[model samples]
Target: MPPIDTSIKEHLNALLDRGKGAGAAKAPAASPVSTALQRDGASVDFENVIAEMLGAIQDMETQLSSVLEINTLLETDLNQAKERIRELRQEREKLLSTIARLEEEMPSKRELQMVIDQLIEERSDAEITIRDLRRRDEQVGAVLKGLQDAQRALEDSRAQLQSELAAVEVRLEAALKDCGKLETRNRALEEKNAANAAAIKELEADLRMALDERFRLSIELDETRRALAAMQGR
Candidate 1:
């Protein structure tokens, strides 16, 4: 297609050139009304062409302004999109760093579960140990009670023995007092028997002296009787 300006100029030059050619070919006896009509037709054609050209130019200017506005809006949207993508990239990097740091600080799932299981087992063992210790404490308490009972029994028996020993000692003291009295009585009887034996020895000596005296007296008496009887017979 031709340029709007160029087409308008070409159309106008063609009408002018046709007018010149018509004037040269026509006789000078052309009517004034027909000439006036020709000039009016030429002017109308020029005005129509000019109006079409102006309308086309105005339409082009309006289309160019719309395109510029659309381009400006598109550029603004593109720039905003680019800035948003950059922010997203930075956020993604920060999230990746956070994930890496957390991974280093925390344990793996399997290892953490194993540690928890071990802790549970340890708690179970501690509970069992506490139960065993409580049982042992009860046994020790029973043994201590038994020992206390034995001690009380031994103390009672000792008290009983002490009472029996006191009674025996009292009986021995009484018997010892009786033995002392018997020894004193036996000594007095022995002294009395000694005095009686001395008296019996003196009596025996006096009886022997008397018997000899009697015998001497009897002999003398018999001699006298014999003398007297002899005298009488003489």
Candidate 2:
């Protein structure tokens, strides 16, 4: 932000003081500001006020820019998490397929009894392999469940971020609109002040003419009185 020009404030104050001084020196006349300069703070430093507002808006935008960058990173993370979930789901499907194939190839109870009698050791090995497959399937199921829960959490976080971003955008828009309105109001005040200045000049001129006329009338009255007193003495 640029430094505020204190000179403008000083100039405006000087003008107001001068106007007051001029009014006090002359006969009482209607004030132009009381009637014509209706806007608030006709003598206030509006430029400085506007500059401050702009600076605040710039700050807000900068902060929002940072927030946007953070949101982008979070979105990237969300995407990565989704991809991981997809891969896990694919693995789970493959595991299920393997389990289905193994079940289809397994022997019936009567065949198992016959195989047990012919190869008891091989049956024990088959049992152990089947138990391991079941345990692996359970592990895959647990992993998939955990991934689903994490996905839900990420989605919730993303939704919150989106809501906050939307609100910030709304506030930024409102601030900009307010800035435009202040500019319009400042322009209107400048025009009003200009018109008031012209009117004051004309009023001052009329006052000077009136003062001159009064002075002339007073001199003539004194001369008439002197002439009458001289005639009365004769």
Question: Local error of candidate 2 at 88, Å?
Answer: 41
Q: What is the per-residue lDDT of model 1 for residues 1-234, given as tens digits with 9 covering 90 to 100?
A: 112345544654565566567657945543444466467762233334444444544454455455455556555655655555555455555555654554465445576457556655555555657876566556555655665565566556556655555654565555555545544554554454444344433433343343344345446534644564566578
Off by over 4 Å in 1: 1-44, 120-234
Task: Give the alpha carbon lDDT tens digit for every residue of 182-203 in model 2.
Answer: 4555455455545544544454
Residue 205 local lDDT, model 1? 39
Clashing pairs in 1: none
Per-model CA lDDT versus the true structure:
0.51, 0.51
Q: Return model 2's CA RMSD, one decimal.
A: 19.2
Model 1, global lDDT = 0.51
* Local error of candidate 2 at residue 229 (angstroms): 14
